[model samples]
Target: MRCQTCGDATSPEHHECQRCYTPLGQPAVTPGLPTYRVRGIGLAANVAVGATAVLYLVVALYPLIGMVMARRAMANDDPDLLVSALIISAVVALIMTVAQLTAAVLVIIWTWRARKNTDAFPGAEPAFGPGWAIAGWLVPFANFVVPARVVAGVARDSLWRRATPPLVAVWWCSWLVFSIGERLATRADDRAYEKLAETPFDDAGYQAYVDHYQDALLRNTVPALGCVIAAVTLILLIQRISAAQEARIAHATPQWPTAPIWPAQVWPAAQPASGVQSAPGAQSASGVPGVQPAAAAQPLSEVPGAAPAS
Candidate 1:
């Protein structure tokens, strides 16, 4: 094996170089800087988004439940059932609104984390988290287009910079379109309800209200589907980037050998005495007492009647 510090051949069992004596696997001389726990933040954000989205599902679907209850109330002429359903439906809508806002907040955090994590990567850009811009979706008039464009721009950045995949672009774009459609459908349903309220004494307009309610229900599904697709894409992109980075780091680092053996020079064992006298300088400097030698410590091969050492 070779010593990493001195770049010289070394025995496998030694931690220090034989020539320079420098310590070979000591920690980095300069302490490594701490990095943001980007993976953990992303995981938390994903969890929050998932939970909020589930709450949104319940809230968003409440109106349909309300519609069903309202129809039952109308057919049976039960004012109590009608009032109860209306209140429940209204509360659920309010909850859904809150969940959507919360999800938007989480998405912003996710975007910021993504940018921060990518900062140290080779060829990284100067973009901040997209969460700052996605907040525009919560705005009334601006929500119609700005949010979608912001997502598209981020997605584009991800692809061009190799920050994320092309599928992310598609997913965010679909989400933006669906979000706008859902808002419009919701407004239409609200307006229909208002119109129905104004003609409270007439039962003839109930069908129109039901139709608008169904439209909102169907329109909301688009955004839900888009969210599901986006979530899946995000998971895949994160895994790929993370794995690539890990492999690169591992490959760049040096590895040490694990064996305990050494390769020092080897010498043959001395032969036993042949009851013959040795010539001058026949024995080694740190002489073995019982060993016989050749004439003047001649090589073992030339020694007479000195069978090779067992």
Candidate 2:
């Protein structure tokens, strides 16, 4: 049968269309199962994440910009310019941080909704419960693995048990790299600051501290690149899963036929066959059972004016 929504051809056994996941016919509603309405949040999530990715690109330029500014300031012996550059970089970093947090929240909400919708799909068994969609990102060590698993489950169940794309793994790996690399860079900065504090008065030690700080700033590019990659891949994944869920929801909804109903006609009863005679007390030739033929016509002897019968 062709799907009513997408016009895709599907087998009689399939309740939903393969292309759009729209229900082929009226689907049976299971008793006691709560209905989950799937909403399209992918676009919003993508916008936020795409913005975050762009900000990551800007953040990546920070280390290179910082190193150049530092060197030029040192060469020109202008301390003020160096201070100004640092302040600008700080402001940009702050903005990027806010955007990242906002994107994360939107993504979590989208995933939660998607996971919940899987319950409404026929034969869709998600690996994780809907709660994990949020909690997976909050738990410390488990966050590394759980969030990916949750996303994978949503993808698999949403696409009618299809295999998840490699993009999920790529996104997870990049996210891990960005997270770990950022932590290392932060620690390195802290150690460099501690050393500088210990030798505040030594000119040679101060020079070494400056070089260390510049090197640390340069190293930030790795994590920044990782963040960029992670954001892009995540946006794609979100779009795919959201679209699939929407299709599935469309399939589940009941659609009433639009054609008008006409009243049925009452057929008249059958008549006996013409010119066919039946013996007296016999059934009619029309083949109507238990219906005897009319009484035979009166004889001439029974007429009043006729001579008496012998």
Candidate 3:
């Protein structure tokens, strides 16, 4: 039913809306988990994503700086300064990686809970279930498709409608672009690292390879830009979806069906109910067996005070 106060859909089992806290009625059914909890989780996840994304921007700039500094080094620049900067960048990158992983986990949790609340909503019929939240992110080739689909579904459901989630699409595209760029940069850097270890810096070929390494580092800026966009977009999208769920919850009424009531069986009592008795051959309302109805009767001739039959 639609919430009378806000016109948002909700289950009758809920005493109040998970979003607006608007009272619907007496508990009629078991409602889905609370929306406030999902909101809290989303907020925390956003903080993590936002902070990590900012640091990522720093990480991205370091490579560009490194590439430039390498050129200076080849021109008889201060190698010690370059070495110190790289060491510090590496340490920062390690910290960012750890933080990013933690944030990603929190985001998954938020998605799962959001999907659950949507499913519980009065008119909701989401396309995906909770498991998709994790599976979409972890699957190999399918990861690209599933994660977007799952996120889209949650956002769409939050609106309590079937329209495409435009923000979701935008955020996803940014994320995809960022992922590809980061991968390419990392792969190139790894190759360079292995080659450098094999061939000493003083080798004749090392000078030529340095140019190629600089180019690889320069290439990373594009993806790093994408990462910043994706991070900002992601945080906004999360907040928007949470608000949508709350609005939907506010207008909704409990959709749960009324529980069935069963008749109670009264046990046989020592005395007839209401000090009254049933007439002869009447069926007892209590439905007990082996109990005869109470009534007054004349004594039989077999008894000491018996009255003879007329």
Candidate 4:
């Protein structure tokens, strides 16, 4: 229907006109995702999340470097340096943890909004919502199993419009398995150290346990890194999908003409017949008196011998 206020086309589904932003009583406006507006917001939110993530990484790096240096100092019997490094590591780790968690929260919020915008468009479903939100992150023991699956589900739904993407599902399962294994390994290492504290440790046994625990921790880092890398890759993939979807919508929409083209080039101009002069005064074709020039321009009621104009 055409909007009564602005005469812009609107859809029966919407009560407000998209073009004029007016409340529609009878007329309507065009129906669509309003892609341009939604994408702008989505992109801004995404950028904010990315910036926060970068800040998290910066904070995290200091702790990691400090931890390595502290361990080296301990081995070398540098007591003063070891204590300083430990303090620095604790501070950096605390800051890093807080920043990382905050960034994750922002990411979830941004993705949720983006999903809503996607739903407004055709051929799109909400990929980020409460269901996925709860499943996506830490929640006691539940965190160990749900997050990988949540990531895969969100990706599959948003990018493929499916409940699962084959590759993503398989990789996510592997992530969950490795994550559980990592936690179990960590617990076992702690238990071993507790046993050593109870029983006096021989130099050989203590060194051997230390070596083994260090190896286990090193191995677990691989999977943990894999999960992080995967998350980053998936986010980039989602961004590409957003761009592609926008391009498709732009291509499909009808375009208006830049300027009007008239038919003057196609038809010949009309010419008067010989001796058929155009009227100068009040004269008609059959020699009858024509209406005055003033009357001709006035209402037909005032013009004698002229038909009323509709």
lDDT of each model, Cα atoms only? Answer: 0.53, 0.70, 0.69, 0.49
lDDT string for model 1 (185-303, tens) is 67876776666543333344444445556766776776666666655665555444444334433433457888887655333255534544544445444364433434234545456
Which is better, 1 or 4, measured by lDDT?
A: 1
Error of 4 at 54 (Å): 8.4
Write one digit per residue (lDDT tens) for candidate 4, span 173-213: 54464456545655764565465322213444334434544
Poorly placed runs, candidate 1 (over 4 Å): 1-34, 126-164, 198-209, 235-310
Distance from true location, Cα of 212 in model 4, Å: 9.8
User: In angstroms, how far off is 191's CA in candidate 4?
Assistant: 7.3
Clashes of 3: 12
Taking all chains together, each candidate's TM-score versus the true structure is: 0.55, 0.68, 0.65, 0.46
Better of 2 and 4 by TM-score: 2
Candidate 2 stretches greater than 4 Å from native? 1-40, 193-214, 256-310
Between candidates 2 and 3, the lDDT winner: 2
Summarize candidate 2's per-residue lDDT along 1-310 as a digit string, tens digits. Answer: 6665455678877777676454666332233556454444678878888898788677666656766665665656555655666588779979988988988898888988888777766555588999999999999998989999999888777655467668888999999999899889768866765664442334444455467657776777788888888988988788777776677556557778898976554322443355333334544444544453344323445645766657
